[model samples]
Target: MVNKLPLSGETVIFTSTKKSEEPYELVRQLGGNPVSYPLIRTEERVSVNDDERMMQTRNYDWLIFTSQSAVAAFHHKLKRFKMDVQDYELRVAAVGEKTAHALERIGFRVDFIPDVFSADVFVRQFNPEGESLRALFIKGNLAGTLISTELSLSVDEWTVYETLPEVSSAARIVELVKDTTSVTVLFASPSAVTVFTEHVAPKIGWAGYTIGAIGHITKRALHRMGAPVHVMPETYTLPELVQTLAGSKGRN
Candidate 1:
């Protein structure tokens, strides 16, 4: 007996910064057709102040990375400045598994990852006392302010990238979602959710479609934008979200 895949004959629309091959391939592996249209784009920003601060990396006690983009941007900046990351004597803190993996890929020894995979969770769990414990936060310009504001350590933040809305043609997005009874829209970030809501929500009504949020932040953004979310995995990862959506076929 040939067992059918959970997401067989379904179409999933991915709205994020870029069309990643891994997620698309994963969706195909799960027997689903993946349509990728980035509604947000990430532009790496050169922070002169941060570049100067990078020279003094040894002074910081901890280096925090919230997203994979941040890790990539920070590493790119380091290479551009002719800095050797391996020489920096700093403990690294990554927000989630993906972010940690990104750091690990670049030869960084991640010292901490919170139980929960959110900035709020990371900040609350990483309770650093005193201003003497200086931590550098490498993040995007659109990042939430909660982590830096909440962390007890003296924080030095560097905006290494900016996320801007990259709305595609309404016709293109509409065509991608055409005639799909259960088009699962995947949102990985708050910016992606915001852009989708602003551009695509009006054309596609809430009926006959399912929204899948990758994490708490994305889910909260959907709620704030008045978009319905049908699938949100306990684990904030692409694989888990895809699995949750596969299992959420019959559920409202």
Candidate 2:
């Protein structure tokens, strides 16, 4: 007699900018058939003044990172410019643990992380001093202005990457979601949620499937589109989302 895995026989769908291996492997480990139906793609932005922008970080007191992609793009620019992060006298604040880990991997010492991993929560909790600190926020093009608007600091934003919808994947998404009885679709970003609602939901009509969102923003996006969100973890991370789904046995 073998014990049944938590996500046994469930078809888990990942709809994000990129298909990450960690969460896919986790879903597979729990006996789910994981599918990568990316609804969005990210591209790093390049500029002629990349060197000047990279050098500008030295003047900021804090380097704020909201996503792992931003960290990756930042690191890539640093490497291209042959600049070492350690040489800059800047404190770093990450919106979540994953972003912090990504920064740490690239030799940055993360000084702050919000209790909750959302931009609104981050704005409320970060920089208690209100001492007119200057921060450079490295982010994707579609990121919200909440952080820049709410933070009582001299905040400047640099668009390192842009998130674009993978409109070509619409047919594949519809095909994979055809059998919805054992399917669990997970969305990571609001941008992906927007893409799905616009392109895929029109075909499938937003029913007969289990839906999971990574953060409040994504959940809100799904709700605004009249899609029912079945599962949302307390923590806004992929591992937590997978664990939450597994613990629930992939059910509503």
Candidate 3:
């Protein structure tokens, strides 16, 4: 027999620029209302410097992808620059399963995925040796220097995309979230957390809301911003995050 869904009458607010199907569908399956309040918007970075940096990817030994958006933006740039994916003899390293899957969907094989889905863990486990291990990180504008700072390898980065706060104003975001009685705010990255804390937290505190994070890194971001985390999945995936939140105490 099929099991009954727990989030039958609950509401979940997800913060992401692009539309994601898994979490939204899961909320509907569990009979919960899914609200997409995208607080972060990502766009490609176009410049002569960006183009020149992208052309230099072939010289790097490893290409590091931090997010799915980076993978998509990178592929889009590749076609625009007329660079064949196969022409770059570089191994791929992804920070999380979703990033790896995004690369796989585009026919790129990910050679390395850290045990933990965090940049700190990824860099520690990278184990770069010798001077020949040149690394290139394709990341967004809001990415921290932690990965490049921690990695022992000679690393260069290209800002393939930039993340902007999308709510327009704090008053607008506060108005959107004020009516959510049984609210659960889902965060996918540190950037989203930053955007929320800077834009929304001041207007409406986390008084009657629960916070859900995709991974420990995001959970830490919530903690750093003084937001309480009510649910965090063991695995950093949208499906797992939704399932965990559905099973949270008092959420039903």
Native RMSD of candidate 2 (Å)? 1.9
Q: Taking the tens digit of each residue's C-alpha lDDT, what string does model 2 give over 1-252?
A: 334588888898888755358988988898988888888988899999999999998899899999999999999999999999779897999999999999999999999999999999999998646477899999999999998899888899999998988998888879877955688899999899889988999999889788999989999999999999988999999879988888777343
Query: Please, what are the lDDT tens digits per residue for candidate 3 over residues 1-252?
Result: 334677766787788764468789989888788877788888887887767777788888999998998998998988887887778777899998889989988778899999888888887898755776889888999888987788888888788888888866445557756865666778888888887888789889866787899888888888988888989998888888889887883343
* Cand. 2 Cα-lDDT: 0.89
Q: TM-scores across all candidates?
A: 0.92, 0.95, 0.91
In terms of TM-score, how similar is model 2 to the real structure? 0.95
Off by over 4 Å in 1: 1-3, 47-50, 128-131, 250-252
Candidate 2 regions with alpha-carbon error over 4 angstroms: 1-4, 128-130, 250-252
| 96: Cα error in model 3, Å | 0.8
Which pairs clash in the backbone of model 1?
A: none
| Better model by TM-score: candidate 2 vs candidate 3 | 2
Model 2, C-alpha of 75: deviation from truth (Å): 1.0
Where does candidate 2 clash, by residue pair? none
Q: Give the candidates in order of lDDT, highest first.
A: 2, 3, 1
Which parts of model 3 are misplaced by more than 4 Å? 1-3, 128-131, 169-173, 249-252
